[model samples]
Target chain A: MEFWVNRDCFYKAISDVSRAVSAKTSIPILTGIQIIATEEKLTLVGSNSDIFIESNIPMTINNEKILDIFEPGSVIISAKYLIEIVKKLPNDVHVKMNGRQLVTIKSDDIITTLNGFQADDYPKLPRIDEDASVRLSNTELKELINQTTFAVSKNENKPVLTGVYLSFQEKQLTLAATNSHRLAIRKLFIEAYLDGACIVPGTSLNELSKLMQDESGHIHIYITESYITFKSVNMTLYSRLIEGNYPNVLGLLPKDAKTVITIKTSQLLKGIDRASLFAYEGKNNRINIEIEDGSKMRISSNSSEVGKIEELQNIKEINGQRDLNIAFDGRFLMDALKAIKEEEIQLSFGGSMRPVLIEPIGNPNYLHLISPVRTY
Target chain B: MEFWVNRDCFYKAISDVSRAVSAKTSIPILTGIQIIATEEKLTLVGSNSDIFIESNIPMTINNEKILDIFEPGSVIISAKYLIEIVKKLPNDVHVKMNGRQLVTIKSDDIITTLNGFQADDYPKLPRIDEDASVRLSNTELKELINQTTFAVSKNENKPVLTGVYLSFQEKQLTLAATNSHRLAIRKLFIEAYLDGACIVPGTSLNELSKLMQDESGHIHIYITESYITFKSVNMTLYSRLIEGNYPNVLGLLPKDAKTVITIKTSQLLKGIDRASLFAYEGKNNRINIEIEDGSKMRISSNSSEVGKIEELQNIKEINGQRDLNIAFDGRFLMDALKAIKEEEIQLSFGGSMRPVLIEPIGNPNYLHLISPVRTY
Candidate 1:
């Protein structure tokens, strides 16, 4: 089999699929990327048992020929070394396979011969039926993943919490992630009415988000009993659904808050950012916020060995109780503020020891709840 | 003590001196930067026993007052934390000392109080006599440091080889560094006649290089019995000389060459960089080069488990012997090529087993020598 491909096109295809390549897998074949050249297109596949990514380069794109195929064949090459060779080679790369295992790549005055494995050694990707499929815009899919994935538990001890829980009900898609200490939830309207929840691993969502383009397009999601597949233009990503039930985090949020205040988002973010320096030395990375005179907010932290920081930030409006103090992990507040897109934010406190709710002003699409630390 | 200083000026001063701060030193005070406030200027000092860095910020620059000193005193604060606080604080920083140890830093609505140590606990910097000194332009000094430092031995088994050797004689300054396998030498004119040599640790020279500005100014270098001091505009850097006799490398350079070739420096660098990909899997990262037909040079490498790569690079000129083969560490060649600033470089090979010499076509200020490896 022999084919010549543009260096830039081939490099991009390899780089996109390499995100799923596992360099230290026990199965040696998993460390290689499967490459197949057919009459229609050239495809590259990378997988590590948890997620599989496949990217295709069409024979022609935008009326420009990108790949020309003279023969149809497949071979699995070491993803790590092939990328290094392709990156160093000049503009056009000529690839040919002698027998089933030896692949030769040449460009300019340089030539490289790579020992490859038979394509039969690669594991077959699972095929999920499109019986329960849903379609969403690429922008909505990207936004849903970004707003809630940060709250997923990094500790694998609780497998269910390590994934983001997705629920579709009444033409609305609800995404929720929680690590027990903090929870984030976002909702967006969809066209489907499927009523069920599935847990997709946080790492899978993150990789899928990177593969997707920000431009307007439709993403078709197909679900099976074991895996979920997201298909977009020239790419298909498959992730294994976590096996277990995700806990209901809706009950953890506070029903009513005694003190609520509206403040500039950037001002509060800067104040907390400064307070975090000293709070890092504290036992729980805790920073305290207190309402003052019904028109001002104070953020403060202290460490006996390091120093103390106090920042008084002005507020636009405050209601109900005044001078109510609450303390929580500074990192939790920073993460919530980063995901919030509004210029103004509203912070509500139930009490000193209760969970605090943060939301973008006048926006009902996002919510973040953090459990306060008890500081006596 | 009480003073108000611009945040940017203080930050830059701290950053320069903080390079010498040692976090895991047996002497606790070494981790803290000593700050002294006098009537005219504020000074910050950091030391790690082997090296000392001091930066001064004057109260008035060109009739513009940068600092307002209300009281005069001294204190030592943790370099790690002080930098973090200063970086986050706003505009002008207000600093005050209470009694002997507690320090308060304030800016805008934020206040930070830090526990510091009495200035008396900090070690005093040694006073170097300027009886024997030499001066050189900043460009020459910087160039001299950059050309030789990379060749210094990183292994400390033989401590002397880990330092750059400097010889001053006949109004010329000679700087040489070698790891035993490769050597780099550079010479520039200086303004003194002290005929002696000293070995300065490569790590210290690297840090001193970062602190030196690229502008044109005279650098006053003072040498004492044990230390060498480089005094630039507002900074003084002191480094202890490595005590040992440096072996004479002048006798190792070949007197004549069997084959010589002149080629573009960038082309040779790129060829070696590409050859490095396959060479990494080989023993010692070895790549072979052989002149063919008196004009073409072949760079090739092979790994039994991976693959083989061959590259033919065209040369501008080849003199003497027609066909000769030599192999060496690709990394060594790359380093030497990077340090050479000439567009056209000449490579001279004495024999298959003899050392090879590389020099710029028209420049006599720099020379690099590398020993070839025996493959048989």
Candidate 2:
């Protein structure tokens, strides 16, 4: 294989695909990225056992000759060293491998040669069924992952909880994640529909969210029985589906809230943050929210060792019945608040005994529920 | 004590004083900051046995009322908790501490009460002698610390080597540091002078450099028998002097050169950085520089396990009459280059076995010496 590619373009492709490459893998070759050079494009693939990412660089982009392919071939090179080398190269990189285990990379006067593995040793990519492909704008895809991924269980005792549950029916897709303590659910209307539900690892969704931030194109998702693939113009991500039945969480949603409090999101977030500091130093990181006559709100936390903090803010709007007091894990509350990108939010409390339903003032598609802590 | 201070000013003083405060201390009170409120100013002091930092918030600055003293008193508050509270407070912070050991900090509608300790338990400040004082601009002080500190020996086997040797003689203050492998020396002319030399801890100098970056006033350095104090208008830092006789490093300076090469500092730094990648993977992180025919230079590193990299750049200018090949630690070379902050640098070589002298082309106040690695 012999090819000369633009330094920056090659670096981006390598880095994008390397998001899936982990140095600590059971299989040695899994730590390397496979590089395939063809007459039309160069392909870079990286994978651990759970995630696979591929990025492609064409020979010409926007009428600019970005790649010169003297020969077409393939090699698997160590991702760690190759990335470091390519990131620091000052000019276009020239790569050559002629039926040998050594791949030579030359840029300007700097030449680096790394030991490569045979491409035949790489694992085969999973076959993605093309029959039921769903297309969503990058923004919608990002929102689906960000709003729900944070609520996924960090504990692996129940593997299904460690992944985000995706359900599609009736031209709408719903994403939910819960760690038994709190839950986040978001729904968006889609042009097409899928038949069933699947669970994708929260970590993969996290990586996808960050990568998609810079992606402007729409994403096409295709799923097989065991693997799910998200494809864009130049990038592809495939994640192994968690093999388990997700717990039925729709029943856990509150039917309605008795007391609803609407307040500025920033003000509430800052108040909770200060209160949580003291709560964290003391007992179970619990902050209590008190609503009085559905007119005013107070957020307070008491810590015997450190200090105690109490913040009172005037409510923008209030509705429903008598007073209600509820306590929640401070960190969980902060997570839900940060995930929200709105100015004002509504908190619907269920008499301080049931979970609090949180939603943006205007957007009804996103909802976060936090179970109140029992202080008894 | 009862006082109302500007929230931003209070936070700044708390953070600056908290730099010397470490939670992991044998004496628990040492982990807290002593807050002394008087009609004149509010003083915050933190100590960790080795370093002490004091910052003051005056009653008014530039006709603006920044502090209002209600009752004059003092208390010791935990630095960890106080910093967090002050950082998140919304408006002017009003601090009130009566005869009780509880300190109440109120801002906006948020009230926080933290447990405090008696101010008597806080350590006393070091008394700096008033005999000979040296004053340096913040920029000069920063340069003095930045240029030589990196070469200080991290190994404590030679305790004196862990500090920078400061010698004041002939209206000049010379600083020197060496790890036995490399040495960095810098000299600057001062208006005043001291008779003797002392050793200051490298870590202390590092912290002081970072803190002084934002300080606009001149720094007056006062030295006692066992302490060195750096005092500005609003901030004062006192560090315990390392008690020992510094080794003689002047003899390590290269007397002359047989081959000299002038190159762009950034270009040379990048070449060495790329070469170091392979060198770090090999033995001893050794990089070789070859000056062939005094017209071109080659920087290269070879690792049998990983690969090898060679970068050749044209030398802008060359001096001396002989060809030379020398090897040095790539990290040491990079450190010297990074510290120079110069466009072009001159490297003077003494054959292939002796130390190389590196200095910025236009500046002579700084000099770096690196011992050649024996590649046999």
Candidate 3:
């Protein structure tokens, strides 16, 4: 495309889309970013097979001139080279389409010509009806994504398990993810009605979280049978939904347990961290947790090569007299503890070998379950 | 060792010595840190084949009890595990030698017993004649190492090129290193006696620079045929010297040149960096530089796949009217520029195809020479 744009404006736009560019993609054109310069704005698009990111820079932003479109055209350039060139350009750059696929960029003292592919070779973005969409604040969506995405299975053997399941009914939206070893669930209230469940890849949720820099603004999400699009100001991200049915995980959480203890989240996190030194040397990083008189808990781990460590954490509230001692993966417990935002957390144990339930104090909407390891 | 030390004191001492511990050594004892507990002091030693670092934590410092030595004993424990355990310990730790080699460390609520190796298995520290040692300020030594070490050859093909050559005569000390392509020479005045030239590996110099954090006082250095010892307050670092004779590079720098140019170091560095982006696509990151009218300079680079970049820099002075253009590796130039602490630098060019001389504006004690590359 023929256009003259400020160095920083073009740089920002190119970087936002470059996140989706993968050099190892099977499709050659997918590695290139598409640039379409109209009389009013310039749109940059980059896509891999699973996710696509597009950003637009208008000719006028806040009544300030950002670009001058000499001619309306489109071209596709290597995302890697485009970013490096734009960042290293001395001043404002003038970009022009040379031959059929050659793009020339000229700055104050530097002139560079890069090979470009035909814009038509790039894949088309998914289209969905804008009217059938749900709205949620960036803060709420980012929080929900962070709380559950880490627990998603990284293996692609079971496609649905690699994605986070989202279900919305009335004003409540629930997100859950599990990798069989651990499960995380979170719920929040929204203003729109979303009744259907969709499986979104954990990677896409991570990218969306990074793009949501502002917390207060609302993000519009349009969902189709196969794809979902999240649109914000000047940017749109499209992600393909995994095709399959998600497993039911509600039965994994405990409804009643023999012992329940509430302890300060930070205090218990530090204790587990100390014990992890010895646990990390063990076969499975297994650490034992013992609750005594319901109000006292001791964490211990040991290895033959390294030494042993036992830390006693104080519990403020206890429900039953039954004592329970169980061993679980220290990493999973650390992750769950970090996700808890409240001052105190309640841990419910069904048995020595059963899945343990961890949740923020007085909050049942967010629950974390970890399967204990057989240490014996 | 049997001792009771404050958590912070023990942690700091162990961390310093662990830097010298080698996990890939053929000798298994080299992976462990030797701890010798005396009635007055506790010493920690860690070593690889090339370097050894020892730090002492005394029982009393400034009339304050930092370490309490219950008995006199010695043992060697895995450096990796010991560091991790001491770092995570809650408060004061009580360390005791159980049998001959087994050790137990007890903190407030944690008790750990680790298997240890016999202290006799560890190699003894090298002995040097301290009477013939020379003293230099830590700041001066650190500066000299930084100014010349980066130019040392990283390839082990020629072992001597990997070390920095140090020569002392009367009170002047000259340090030089070259990788055949570029050379860095630095000279300083030290109050020392006659000492033959010594070759110290660049890797050892780099590590020594980091270990010499105390810049207030002088450090005593004892150099031998096989090893060099650097002694500070309660720390001693011993490094094996590389065995070989360094090449003579005193005549590589041009004493007289047809053209001389003075430019701001920062501006030239930035120009070269920008031009290198395109040049990097070529076989060797080669960038061209042209000086015009003794006051202006231009830098440019281009690749067929990527574009081209040209930057113009203003110079303060030029001694000759002859215009000279040359091409060189951008990475080498960047490294030399970063080593130069002066604001302005003087460059002397002998011809279009010869090495260029770069030195600080008024300082003749330090010089850097870079060979030019043929662009055609």
Candidate 4:
């Protein structure tokens, strides 16, 4: 196969697909990326046993030709090597494959050759049917993944909790993730008929989120018993689902709270951050927040080994008696606050030992709950 | 002791000194930075037994008042914790030390307290006589360190090779370093009366280089039998000298070469970069460069498991014979090329296995030599 392709376009597609290629794989051929050129498009695919990503370069985009193909064929070259060569090469790269599968890449006066394997040795992507797919804006999907993925349990003992639990019903999509200590929930509404729940591995969701950044096109999602596929523009991502049931987390959030306070997001975030400097070095990264009067709250953390930090921030509103104190892991609190996209946040607490609910001021679309640490 | 210092200025001073503090140390006091405030200036010092860096913030700079000192005292606080607190605190930070050595730092509504050690527990910096010192521009001193420090041997088995060797006589300063495989040498002429040679640890020179990046003032260097001190307007850096004789590398460089090739610095650098892609994965990272007929050179590298690359770059000038092929480690070539601050470089090769010398086209102050690999 021989072709002259736009260097930037080819480099971008190769990079996107290479994210799925694992450096360590049981199957030798899985470390390589498969490149195929058909009559209309050129496709590059990379996969490990867990996930696969494919990106296509259309022969013509926006009425302008991007690739001039002399012959249509396929080859599988080492992804690690191909990316380095392409990234360093100048623009308007020319690539050709001989009958012996020797791939040559040339730009300016620089030439690189790599021995590639037969395309037949590379694994093919599982066929996904378009009729069983639902369409949603890429922005909505990205938001749902980011809002909950950070809360997934890192412990491998519970396989289902290691993935973001995604549930779809009627026209509403709900995403939730919890690590037993903290939980995040987000919902988006789309006009589609889909009913099912799938647990996508946290790593897959993170990679998908990064790939979909600045991408505003519609994403067509297809789910099967074993795998889920997300297709947008000329890229398709397939991730294997965890074979188990996600924990029921809706019951973990309480409907009633004894005290509630609304405070500036940035001010409270900075307070917790300063407390974390000392708390992080101790056995427990615990920071306590005490409600002082109606318009002020004191956040303090003490480490007998390090030192202590006490910060006071003014509250926008409060609806409860004073003298309420609660403690939480600094990391969990920081993560929840960082994901919020609002200036003011309302935190509701049932008691010193109960789970605290945090949500954006006027938005009901996202909520984060954390079980407070009991400090005696 | 009490003081209200500019947060940004204090933070910058702390960061510079903290670079000398080692987290893993046998002496507990060395892990902390010693802070001393006198009637005129406040000093911050960090030490790891081998090197000590001290920075002073004077009460006035450029005829403008910088600090208002209320009392004079000293205390030692954990360097790692102090840096974190100062960096995150708001502007106009107020610090005070109580009778029990409890240090309080406050900014706005944020308050942080740290238990500090008595200043008497901290080690004192070695005294060096300024009568025998030499003065040079900060830029000149920094350049001398950067140009030769990277070639220092990382292996500590030979303690002297781990430091850059400095020789001074007749108003001339010469710096040299080598890993036994490659060597870099630099020379500078300054107006000073000094005579002696000493070896300063490579790590110390690197940190000193970073600290002096924006300093344009003069640096007075004081050297004793075992220690060297670098003093500037408001900062002093003390480093212990390696207690062994440096290897003599003067005889390793030949006076004549059989072949010479003059080429653009960037073009040749890029050529080797591409060749390094395949060469680095191999056992020796060996890449062969051949001088073609007239003013053209072919740079190539081959890996039996990976592939091969051949790049041809135009040479600006050629001296002596053609068809001379030599092989060297790609990394060494890249490092040598990167250190040359010139548009063009001239490389001289004596033979296939001999040490090849690289120097800038017009500048002779710096030279680098790399031993070629004997490929059978």
Candidate with top TM-score is 2
Two-chain DockQ for model 1: 0.83
Q: Tens digit of lDDT per residue, candidate 1, span B309-341?
A: 888999999889987888999999999999889
What lDDT score goes with residue B361 in model 2? 92
Candidate 1 docking: what grade?
Answer: high
Off by over 4 Å in 4: A62-64, B61-66
User: How well is each residue in A268-294 modelled by candidate 4, as lDDT tens digits?
Assistant: 888899899978876559999998766
Task: Give the Cα error of residue B18 in candidate 1, in Å.
Answer: 0.9
Worst 10 residues of 3 chain A by lDDT: A304-313
TM-score of chain A of each: 0.97, 0.97, 0.96, 0.97
Clashing pairs in 1: none
True-structure lDDT of candidate 1: 0.90
Residue A331 of model 3 has an lDDT of 90
Judged by whole-model lDDT over C-alpha atoms, candidate 2 comes out at 0.90
TM-score of chain B of each: 0.97, 0.97, 0.96, 0.97
Between candidates 2 and 4, the one scoring higher on TM-score is: 2
For each candidate in turn, the TM-score is: 0.97, 0.98, 0.95, 0.97
* Candidate 4 TM-score to native: 0.97
After superposition, candidate 3 runs with Cα above 4 Å error? A60-63, A213-216, A292-295, B60-64, B213-216, B292-295
Candidate 1: residue B59 lDDT (0-100): 88
